[model samples]
Target: MSDTSPFDPVGHESLADAVVEQIETMIVDGILKEGHKLPSERDLAEAMGVSRPKLREALQILESRDLVTVRHGEGSFIAPLSGRAMSPALLALYARHGRAFYDYLEYRREQECFAARTAALRATQSDKDRLRDIIDEMQKAWEEDDAEASQEADLRLHVAVVDASQNTTLIHMMASVYDLTRQGVFYNRRFLRTMDGTGEKLLQQHKDIVATILAGDPDAAEQAARAHLDFVEESFRLGEEQKARETRAAKRRKLSGQASR
Candidate 1:
C-alpha cells in the first residue's frame, strides 16, 4: 500500500487560470500587498500547484501590466501603481474575439506611432533605403497574390522602421510581443483578400512615410505613420464589431431552438 496516498485528487481543465486567480485573490485580500517581494522563483513554483512555465506565463502577464517587476539579478516584486503596461494575456484575450480587437490595435498604434516618431529623428540614410526596399517587397508579394508573404513583408517594413532607430531597447520592446498586433491587422483573415485597388493607397502612404524619414522631417514622418495606422485601425474595429454582432445573433437563434425543443 505504499504509504496510502496522502492527498486527494483535483480536476480542472485550466489549472493555470485557477492558480492565477488564487494569487490575485491573495493580493486583493491583503494577504499580499504592493511592493512586497514574492518568494524566489524556485520557492513560488514549489508553492503553487503549477509548473515553472505556467507560473512564468502568469508572472509575465502581471509584469506586462506592471503588477510585478523583475529586476536584473533579483527576484520578482509586486509593482506599485506603475500605470498600464502591455500584458500578453490582454493581447491574447483581445485577439480571441472581435470586441477585443480594437483595444489591442489601439495599443499597437500607440507603440508604433512612437516608434515612427523616434525613427524619423534617429534613422540613418541606410535605414531609409532599407525601409523602402521592404515596402517594394510588399508590393511585389501583393502583386503575386502571396497573401501570407505580403503580410510578412508589411510587418517587416514596419519592424524595419523600428529597427532603423538602431535602438535595441525599442526593437526588443516591439519584438517581445507583436503577434497579436500582427494577427489583428489580418483579423478575420480579411487581409488575404484583394484590396480593390486600396493597394496603391497603401503604397503611397508608405512612400510618404519613407520620404519624411529621408528628409529628416520628424513632424511629417510622425503624421504619415499615424495616418496609415489610423486607416488599418478603423478597418479592424468595424470588421470586428460586425463579426461580434453576427456571433451574438447566431447564439440567440441557437438558444431559441433549444428552448422550443
Candidate 2:
C-alpha cells in the first residue's frame, strides 16, 4: 500500500512549501553557499521531478523569505544573511498554520513589540496624526457597535503604527505581518461567545497609544504597544489550552470507537 500520511508532498502542505524545504536543506547542509548560482529553472524542475511552474513557485517563496536572490538577467543566487529582516509573514511561515496557531501568535507578538519600540524612536508628527485617526475610527465603530468595522479599524491601527517609522522597505516587508495575528486574536475579539467588551477595551487602549505617539515619545509608544500585546497574548494562551484539551478528547474518542468495533 502507498503511504498517505500528511508528511507526504501531496498532503497537508502546499507543493511549494515542500519544494522550498528541499532546497533549504541543501543550502543549510553547505551544498549551496552565498552567491552560488542555482540550477536553471528547467534543470531544477527536472532534478526535483516537478513541473516548471511548481518549481518557480517554490523559488518565489524562497525569494520572499530572503533565502534566495533572483536576479532578472543573472539568474538566482544564494541570498546573504548579513542583516536579518524579520516580519509577521516570516513568523506565519514558521508557525505552519492552525496546527501552530498559538506558537505563531507568540512569535508575531514579539515582532510587533519590536516594531512598536522602533516606531517610538522614529515616528513623526504625521505618523502621530495617522495613529489618532485610526483610534478615532475605532471609537466611532465601537459606538456604532459594528464588530467588522471595529476589527478592521483595529487592524489598520496596528499596521499604521508599524508603518510610522517611515522606512518604506519595512512598511512593504510587513505588509502581511498581521495576518496570523488577526486570525489568532481577532477571531476571539470578534466572536460574541469569547468576547466581552473587547472592542471597547481596545478602543480605550488605542486612544492611549495615540496620546503617547502625539506626545512624541517612542518609549511611551513602545510601552503602550507592549501592554496591548500582553492582553492579546493572554487571550491566545487560553484559546490554545482549550484547543489542546479538545484535541486530546477527540483522539481518545476515536480510539474508543475503534476498540469497540
Candidate 3:
C-alpha cells in the first residue's frame, strides 16, 4: 500500500476536517500500511492541494488517533494499528487471572481450526514454502535445545497458516490478539514440552498439520490443528492439577512439622 493519488484541492468549508478524512480513508483502505512513511510536508501538501497549515492540522488529527507517529526531525510514519489498542488491556487480563489464559486458548482453537482449513484450501506455493521453512527452523531449534527459538518458530508457523487463509478480516482479528497468543502459548510452550514425550508429540503434530495442508486436505488440516490444541489444553489442565497436589503436600508437611514441634 502507498500514499493515495492526489485529490482536488480542499476548497470545502471544513478544509482541515476534509483533509483529515481523506488521509484517514487512505489509511483505512490500506493504501498507507503500518510503518509506511508519509510524504514530506511540502510534497504532501502539494499533492493533496491543501495548504501546509491545513496538512499540519490533518497530521495532528491522525497523530491524536495514533494512525501516525511523528518523530523529531524524522517524518511521520504509519503507526501499528493492532497492538496499540488492545495489547496492554489483554496483558493486564492475562496477568490478573490464570483462567484468562485458557480462555485465550479456547478462542485460538476456534480461530486456528478455521485458519488451518482455509489455508489447506487456499495456501499459495509461497505460503507452503514459508511453512516448510519455519518447520525446519523448529526442527533445528528443538534438536539444539533452543527452546526460545523453537517457540518463536512454532508461533511463526501458526501465524503463517493464518496468513495463508486469504481472509483480510480473519487476519486482522487474529492479529489483534496476537500478543496474547504469544504470551500465553509461546511463553508456556517450554513448560508444556518438558512433560515426557510431549515435545516429540508436538513436533509430530506440527508436521502433520503442514503435510495435510500441503496435500490440500482441508478436513485433515482442521483435524490436525484440533488434535494438537487438544493436547496442549490437556497438558495445561494436568499441569494445574500437579500444582494443586504439590500445594496440598506442602501444607501437610507444614502441619506435621508443627505437631512435632
Candidate 4:
C-alpha cells in the first residue's frame, strides 16, 4: 500500500469512509477514468490493506453515490461520467446553429491559452514526451499530405496540452469541446483544408505552439496558443465568405442559363 498507489492504505479509524474517499478522489482526478473496472473484492482489499468487509462497505457507498456500477457477474466499474458534458441534444443544436460555432472557438481560445501556459510551467517529462510524439505525428501527416490524419493529430495535440496542464476540469472540458468539433458541430472537416495554403500555415502554427511549450516559456506558450486560435478563427470566416460567394455565383449562372432557354 504505497502512497503512490491509487489505493493507498487506510489510516483513518472509519476504514470504509477512508476507502470511499480515496476512490472518489481518484475518480475526480481522472486517474480512474470512466468505465474503468475495479479490481475483484479480494484483490482490492489486499491492495488497499483493508479488510474485505470494509472494502465491501465502501463499494456499497460508492454505488449509492452513483459513482460506481456493480454488476452481478462482472466486477464494479466507474460509472459513465461524461454524459453531462456531452449531451447529444445540446450538441445537435450547436451543430445546427452557425453562431455556436464561433462562440465555441472563442471559448476554446481562452481555455486553450490557459492550458498552454500552465503546461509550459508544470508539465512533467512524460507529458513533454507525449506532446513531442504528437508533434512528430503532425509533422509526418503534413509531409505526407494526409489532411485527415493531420487534423486528427491537431486535435490530439490540443488535448495533450490540456492533459499536461494537470487540471482535471480543463482536461474533461476540453476533451468534450474537441469531441464536438470532431462531430462537425463547429465546422465541416473540409472548411479549412479546402483553402489554399491553409494547411501549411496551420502546421507552422502548431509547430510554434509546441516550440514555446517545449521551451518552458509560459508567456510565449500562451501567446502562441492565442495566435493559433486567431488564425483558425480568421480562416473559418474566410471560408464561410467564400462559400457564400460560390453560392451566389451558382445562382447567377442558373438564372443566365434559364433566361437563354
Candidate 5:
C-alpha cells in the first residue's frame, strides 16, 4: 500500500488564503484605513511576495466579504467599515434628542477610560510620538484661538489614544463615535471650545493623558481620561443651561414689548 498521506501539501489555495489573512490583518490593525485605495495588482502581488493569480483570488474573497470594494478600472479600495458600523437611523435619533448627548458622553467616558488604560500598556514608540504631535497641534490651535482646529485636534487626540490601545474592536467602534461627534450629532464641539478658559484646560487635560500614557501608567491614564470627560460633561451642562436661560429671557422680553404695544 502506498504510504502517501491523505492530505495534500499546502498549494495555490493556501497561498491565496495567506494573502487574504495578510490583507485582513492590515485592515484590522488600521494600517490600511477605510477608503484607502489598494495598489495596482501587479505592484501589490510583488510587494506581498505572491503571484498575481493568488493576489487576485485573495482580492476577490475580500471583495465578497465586503471588506473591499473593487472598481472595474480604478482598482480596489478598503470599504468604509466604520461608517457602516453605525446606522443612519441611529445617527438621526441621536441627533434629534438632547438626552442623547449626555448618554453619548457617558458611553465615551467608559470607552475612553478603557482605551487610555490599554494604551498605557500597549502603545508603541510611534504611538507616543503621534500623541505628542497632536498635543503640540492642540497647543498651537489654542494659542491662535482657532476653535475649529482645536476641536479637530481634540478628536484626533482621543482617536490616537484609542489607536494606541491596539484593540481592533475599540478602534473601529470609536471611529464611528467620533464621526458622529464631528458631525455634531450629539453636541456641538464648539460649545466645549467656547467656554471660558476651556481651550486651555482642554489642552492641558489632553497633555496629561498623553503624559500618563507615555509613562506607561495605566491607572493615571484611566483617571485622567475620566476627569477630562467629567469636565466636558459639566461644560456641556452649563452651556445648555445658559442657552435655555437666554431663550427664556428673550421670550419674556418679546411678550413684554407686545403687551406694551
Candidate 6:
C-alpha cells in the first residue's frame, strides 16, 4: 500500500476511471503527499498498464477535480488539499451503491460511541463549552425549521465530541470519513423527515449525550451515544419498509386496473 508499484489491471471497460480511482486512493491514503512529484507520464502509464492516452485522460480528470496539478513541461504533482476530501468519483460510488451507506453508518456508530466515552473522561472545560455552543446552534436550527443548518450543526457536534477525546488517531479517522458523514446526514434527511417527532427526539438525544459527557460519566455518555444511533438505525429501517410497502401497493393497483380493462 505504501509503494506505487504497477497496478493489477482488471478487465474493466472504463480503464480511465479505474486509473483515476487508483490514483485517488493513493492520494487519500497519504501515499502521495501534497506537492509530491508524480512519476513521468510514460513511466506512470507503464506502471498502471494503461495506454498513455488513457493515463492522460485520467490525469485530466484528476486535474479538473483539483486533486492533481499538471504544470506544462513539469509533469504532475499532487495538489494541496484545499479543504476538499470528497472526490466526485467517491461520491458517485456511494450514490451508486446504497449498501455502502449502511455499512458506513454501522462503522460510524461504533466509533462515535467510543468517542463519546473518551470525551467524558478527557474533555476540558473549554471542550464542554464548545460542545454546548454547537448544541445551542443545533437547537436554534431546529427551531427555525432550517434542516440544512441543523444537519451541519449535528455533524459539528459529533466531530467536536471526537476532538474532545484528545485522541489524534480518532480525529484523523473521522476526518478521513468526513465526506461520507456529510453525505449520510444529507441522504438520511429525506427519511428522517418522514419519521414523526424525529427532529425533537434528535435534539433531545444530542443534549443528553453532551450532558452525560459533561458530567464526566463515561458509561452514561457511551450509553447515550449508542442509544441515539439505535434510534437512527430504527428510523432508517422503518422508512425503507414504508417505501417498500408503498411500491408494492402501487404495483398491485396497476395490475388490478389492467385486469379490469
**Top model number, lDDT:** 5
Better of 1 and 2 by TM-score: 1
On TM-score, the stronger of 3 and 6 is: 3
> Of the pair 4 and 6, which is ahead by lDDT?
4
Compared with the true structure, what per-residue lDDT tens digits does model 1 show for residues 1-261? 123322122135665566566666665433344566877766676666466787787788778766778886888887764222446676555546555655656766777777778888888776888887887887787677676776677777777787766666566556544544465532633452433244656667777877787787878888898898787776655665777999999999999999999
Tens digit of per-residue lDDT, candidate 6, span 1-261: 124464555346898899999888766644465677988988787777788899899999999999999999899998876344467786787778766767767887899999999999999898999999999999899899888898899888988998888776677577666656676632655457558464888889999999999999999999999998888788877877888999999999999999999
Rank candidates, TM-score, best first: 5, 4, 3, 6, 1, 2
Task: Give candidate 5's TM-score.
Answer: 0.86
The all-Cα superposition gives candidate 5 an RMSD in Å to the true structure of 7.4
Clashes of each: 0, 1, 0, 0, 0, 0
TM-scores of the candidates in the order shown: 0.54, 0.52, 0.72, 0.80, 0.86, 0.65
| Ranking of all candidate structures by their lDDT, best first | 5, 4, 6, 3, 2, 1
Error of 4 at 75 (Å): 5.0
Best by TM-score: 5
Q: In terms of TM-score, how similar is model 6 to the real structure? A: 0.65
Residue 51's lDDT in candidate 4:
92
Local accuracy of candidate 2 as per-residue lDDT tens digits, 88-124: 5755565555545555456656666666777777777
Once fitted onto the true fold, the runs of candidate 6 whose alpha carbons sit more than 4 angstroms away are: 1-91, 184-186
In model 3, the Cα lDDT at residue 52 comes to: 88
C-alpha RMSD for every candidate: 16.7, 16.5, 6.2, 3.5, 7.4, 13.6
